[model samples]
Target chain A: AQRVTQPEKLLSVFKGAPVELKCNYSYSGSPELFWYVQYSRQRLQLLLRHISRESIKGFTADLNKGETSFHLKKPFAQEEDSAMYYCAPTPPTNAGKSTFGDGTTLTVKP
Target chain B: SAVISQKPSRDICQRGTSLTIQCQVDSQVTMMFWYRQQPGQSLTLIATANQGSEATYESGFVIDKFPISRPNLTFSTLTVSNMSPEDSSIYLCSGQTGFETQYFGPGTRLLVL
Candidate 1:
């Protein structure tokens, strides 16, 4: 069974502080992981993917296969960065069927 | 990325009633999926609407309770039957483009009374 675990259900940080949203997976095969963000009153949107290796909105995630983790990180958190984040792991064979992790609600305080 | 839209942005319905949610993608997408998000929970995939064929439902989701239709490549619909207070949640429709990135629609919020 492939499982994505986001241990932190809620995280709070002050503006300009570094933030990292933890995500761990229990998949045996190589997994393609992605981060999705949902701002207040906005639709859920893709933030970044491990395959892309490109940062979006100053957030980046690196796939750590040894540890089976893909943690999203940002150098400086902003008030606008307060949102819900989900970690999704998609198997190569199952491209559209991704197992999403329990989301983390990050609150960046001003 | 495709722009997805959902109908009946929010609704309040009584128990035992059914509500149909429509989804439309501005551009053609390779795959369409329906998901449910309970309050303060993660998104759980309901089914995959296959064009010109019966939908493939996920575990714990049945066709009779949540019938889905995808008559074309850019449109789909999901009907929640026999509603209850437990069914109150946000239902989202997503389109997976050729690039494999998913674009989600503004979900339809259903509140069962």
Candidate 2:
């Protein structure tokens, strides 16, 4: 069975402060990890994927195979960063079958 | 990324009634999937709609409860049959655009009264 776990349901941070949203996954085979963000009144979108090795909207995440964790982080949180973040890991053997974590709602206070 | 749209963005229906949600994608995709998000629960895969074939449902989900159809690569439909209050949830359809990138639709909000 494939599973994705987001430990925090709600995370509040002040603008200019650092933020980290934790995510863990369990899969038998190689896992494809991704971070998806849904801004207020906006559609769910891809924030970043570990395979790309890139940053999106100043947020970055490292896939730690040892820990089986893919935590999203940002140095300076912005007010616009407030949104619902979801962590999904796709079982490569399956046909794009993604296991999604219960999303974390981030609140950036100004 | 692929641009996807879902019809009946939201609907309130009576118990025992059924509603069919439509999903359309701008580009032809290799795979299309349906998901359900219950109140305060994680998004779960309902089934995978295969083109020109019957949908493959996940564990705990059955085709009699949720029938899915995909005649082609760009369009599909998911019907919630004999819905109850427990069936009220956000139904989302997503398509895989690249090797591992899946794009989602806006979602259909269903409220079973």
Candidate 3:
């Protein structure tokens, strides 16, 4: 079974500090990884995808196959970055079905 | 990417009644999915609404309790039947084109009393 794990339910960091939201997945085949964000009162939106290899809103995630992790990281945390972050994994065969981890609520305190 | 819209942005419903959430995509999409986000939890996929076929539900979800309809490529609906307090959650519809990232709707917030 493919599963996504986000160990931290909540993470707090001071503004301007580095932030890392841990995510790990277990799957046999290659997986497509994604980071989705939902700000207060806003729709859930795709932040970034491993295939695109691009960063959005100053956040980036690298797929580490050896570690089975795709941790979201940012060099500096801003108050505006406070939101819920979810790590999702989609099997190569199942394009529409995805497994999402229990999201981590990131709070960037000012 | 596809643009998705969901109807009944927010609704407060009686316990024994039902609510139907509509999802529309701007363009024809290959895949449409329904997800539920319980309070303080991550999104869980409810079902895959395929065009011209019955929906495939995920574990912990059933067809009778959460009936889904996909009459076309760009439209789908999820009906929450016999709602309860546990059914109150944010229901989101997403459309995907060619296995890329999925575009999500604003979501329908249902509060069952």
Candidate 4:
């Protein structure tokens, strides 16, 4: 049973502050990692994926296979970034079913 | 990215009743999945609905409790049978495209009293 853990249940930061949402997984194999965000009253949308090696909405996550972690980071947080963020890891073979971590609710203060 | 939509965005049902949530994708997708998000909790995978085949459910989920139907690549339905108060959760439908990016539907909020 592979488990995904996001240690922080709530994170608060001032605007323009650097933010990092930690994510750790128990899977040993190469699993794909994704960051999903849910704004108020909006559907869960993909923020970024580790396989792509790209950044979206000023957020980037690097997959560290040795540590079994993929931590999302942003240099400067914006008010719009306040949302519930989830880290999901799926087996490379089955991309559809992903194991989601308990979400971290980020609040950007003015 | 594929656009996903779900029917009956929010519903309040009574105990012992069943509610079917419909998921529709704008384009054909390779895989469709059903998930349940309990309040203030992480989303749990319910099943993977395969077109023209029986759904593959997760460990805690069963075919009898959450029957799923995927007639084609663009559509699927999940029926929560004999609902109880514990079944109250947000049901989400997700479609995995060829690019392996998953697009999710606005979840259907279920409240069983």
Docking class of 2: medium
lDDT of 1 by residue, A21-106 (tens): 99999986787788999999899999998988898999999888889999999999999999999998876553557889999999
Model 4 clashing residue pairs (backbone): none
Better of 3 and 4 by DockQ: 4
Give model 1's TM-score versus the native structure: 0.96
Clash list (residue pairs), candidate 1: none
Question: What is the TM-score of each candidate's chain B when compared with the real chain B?
Answer: 0.98, 0.96, 0.96, 0.98
lDDT of 2 by residue, B9-101 (tens): 999999999999999999988789999976455678899999999999999999999999999999999999999999989999999865778
lDDT tens digits, residues B1-113, model 3? 78899998999999999999999999988789999987667988999997888999998999999999999999999999999999999999999777657789999999999
Between candidates 3 and 4, which one is better according to lDDT?
Answer: 4
* Fraction of true A-B contacts recovered by candidate 1: 0.60
lDDT values for all models: 0.93, 0.91, 0.91, 0.92
Residue pairs with clashing backbones, model 3: none
Off by over 4 Å in 3: A93-96
lDDT of each residue in A9-103, candidate 2, tens digit only? 99999999999999999888888899999887777788998988999999999998999999999999999999999999986543667788999
In model 2 chain B, the worst 10-residue window by lDDT is B36-45
TM-score of the A-chain for all models: 0.96, 0.96, 0.95, 0.95
Model 3 lDDT, residue B64, Cα: 95
